[model samples]
Target: MFTNIRKFSAVVVTSGAALALLSACGGTDSASMGGHDMSTMSSSAPAATAASAQPSATFNDADVMFAQMMIPHHQQAVEMAELADTRASDKEIKDLAAKIKAAQDPEIQTMQGWLTAWGKPMPSGGTDHGMGHDMLGMMSEEDMKKLADAKGAAFDKQFAQLMIAHHNGAIEMARTEQSQGSNPEAKDLAKTIEAAQQAEVEQMRKILKRL
Candidate 1:
């Protein structure tokens, strides 16, 4: 009877060891399953972020020049436009001035952003005519003085004529940029300036006839 009891005890101990081994194998499988899920989650997250992001556009040197030169050019136009607001008597002339200011101001900011991005200066300073006749389509000191001093219909007529010439000069510069400018943004802006200024030129000519 004692021998029989010993054999039964041995059978129970062996069964307990087998149960422990099965439990350890199950724990390892659970950890492996959790690790696999974590890896999948990590891999998918970056793809979601990339899908949501916006792609940036590229630019070149011609684009940079177009932005830089046009900023100051537009500034000068804005200044002239403001003068028309205060000094012009004709409603049409004032309207034209306002239009010029509205169009060029935003463009100036756009150019400044380009310059900042391009790591370039505001004006490259290759052309310097001072206050002389050499300046391209620029109003002389005397010309500005005349505009500042004129009154009523005379001021309106003169502003329209001078601005027509100014727009023409801008068109010429834009054409140069179109042909020679290396940057895409600059070339595109040049084309825009050419088209818009040409339209304004025709409008100014019509205004001159009415005046």
Candidate 2:
């Protein structure tokens, strides 16, 4: 699934957009929170406007963490996909890899843009993925090297298995964001990631079965 970008400002802006979008959809029964009438709250807008507050402009700590962690996670996936171009022999595997790369590369940029717009520093420094091996289904450097060195049927099989595992990790993280996140855009993105990765996971399993 393709993701839409939002101008997700910090916490304050997110709250405002929630208010505006809700109001736009139809008035709320109680336009207030914690004794404050959000309808009359009259707070100044964040640095961004509603037009810009897309893909994500309002976010909470959960959204921030989701973006921060997922950035590197998606990056690693892109790296693995790049390797598939040469290493994979099966046409379906190659096409899937290409699709994964196309989908995730822009998502990396979108998340990074959210972090930057929110005034958070993107994880600094090199090719280091900065995620645990089991924490988010990341493969070790050794494993990546192994995949890179492989070709033909061996490469396709290993890639499908590893990518399935990797997609599962991403789906897990995305589910967390959906439940715990405040930014509408971020939550929607999480849903997109979850659905897309789940579909791909099943696809990969079918490919593996054939191999």
Candidate 3:
């Protein structure tokens, strides 16, 4: 009788264990069937957080200064180009001014975008950082007045001379940016400006000689 009792107890324990396992399996299946999607839960995670974990590009103070100063300097060039188009009598001079205006205006927009993205303010006119008075071939008030008042061959000659000086200044600024700027985009722009303005300088010199 005791042996039979022990056998019955073992059978009961095995049955209980099997029921527990069966309940666990049923719960898992219910979770799956009840639209509890583990895969979708993982897929819905924010990717921006993962992206934000990556390193950002670095820039130095010189890079900031270059962008700040050049924006205004390019603005001045565009102004001068507009003036030349209005006042210049020579077709070549007018065409050149128009081209300069076209090129620099887009570049100004690009630089402005950079400043905005970098959280820097647009350059103001009042501050003087000793970047020299001749930033990007800008003429003094007197020189601009002279250009405005001159006419015919005189205007053409003066425009060429002024433009050459202006292009040279742009090249100098671009070189500085190339040497000191840490931002890759700024450095690339500087290189482009250097190449383009250098070419313009040569063309202006030829125009001056012809005049």
Each model's Cα RMSD: 32.0, 12.1, 30.2
lDDT of 3 at 124: 55
TM-score of each model, in listed order = 0.66, 0.73, 0.67
Candidate 2 lDDT by residue in tens digits, 1-211: 1111112113324554564566567754313222111110000111112212235555666677677667666777888899999889999999999888887776777777778788876753332322255555766667887898999999999999888888887887777777767778777777788778888888899999999
Give stretches of model 3 more than 4 Å off.
1-57, 125-131
By TM-score, who's the top model here?
Answer: 2
By summed lDDT, the worst window of 10 consecutive residues in model 3 runs over 36-45
Q: Please give the TM-score that candidate 2 achieves against the real structure.
A: 0.73
**Candidate 3 residue lDDT tens string, 48-143:** 112111123565544555666666566656766777766787898888788777777677667677777777666654312122334235455567
Per-candidate clashes come to: 4, 12, 1
Q: How do the candidates rank by lDDT, highest first?
A: 2, 3, 1
Candidate 3: residue 98 lDDT (0-100): 83
Reference-based TM-score, model 3? 0.67
Residue pairs with backbone atoms closer than 3 Å in model 3 (clashes): 137-166
Residue 119 lDDT (model 2):
88
lDDT of 2 at 27: 51
Whose TM-score is higher: candidate 2's or candidate 3's? 2
Query: Model 2 Cα displacement at 11 (Å)?
Result: 22
User: Which numbered prediction scores highest in lDDT against the true structure?
Assistant: 2
